[model samples]
Target: MLNVARTVRCIDDAACEEVQLFTEEDGEPERLGEYRSVSGLRIDKAKVRDARVFRLWGYHIPIIVDEEIKAALEANGIVGGKFEEV
Candidate 1:
């Protein structure tokens, strides 16, 4: 099991993928392609998606963000919050 208590510490370095503007109750994540294959993605502090911060597993992720959400993410500490890319 992965101990999620540590933010930077993870079981494996995998690039984060874009889930969705809103998470589906079914616990499914939406996939977005990436430009580069990466172990993990650090959430952009500036682009806040919503109450929850979004993270991608790696660098060249192909997920698109909403205009408003992108702006908010950039302006906030979406990276340091209660969310991490798996």
Candidate 2:
């Protein structure tokens, strides 16, 4: 099993639309908007420099993996997960 070390947010330039942002209230912090679809997603490399695996902050559906980990998984013939470069 793979474990995520942290979560990172997409950069401002990410191409997405119709995102719904939830305002901070009742002691809860403001959350990033939810995207039905996103393209040109870019993350701050500095934030994930030490992380081999991580999920997108606030949108945990995409599992990001480093090149080394991707290679290892491919070499091992692991299946079920589809990979796309972000």
The candidate that wins on TM-score is 2
Q: List the residue pairs that clash in candidate 2.
A: none
Clash totals, every prediction: 23, 0
Candidate 1: C-alpha lDDT: 0.36
Whole-model Cα lDDT of every candidate shown, in order:
0.36, 0.66
Locate the minimum summed-lDDT window of 10 residues in model 1: 1-10
How well does each candidate superpose onto the true structure, as a TM-score?
Answer: 0.21, 0.63
The alpha-carbon lDDT assigned to residue 24 of candidate 1 equals 50
lDDT of 1 by residue, 8-65 (tens): 1112223343222223543434533322244344344343334232233433232434
- Pick by lDDT: which candidate is best? 2
Relative to the unseen true structure, what is the C-alpha lDDT of residue 31 in candidate 1, on a scale of 0 to 100?
A: 31
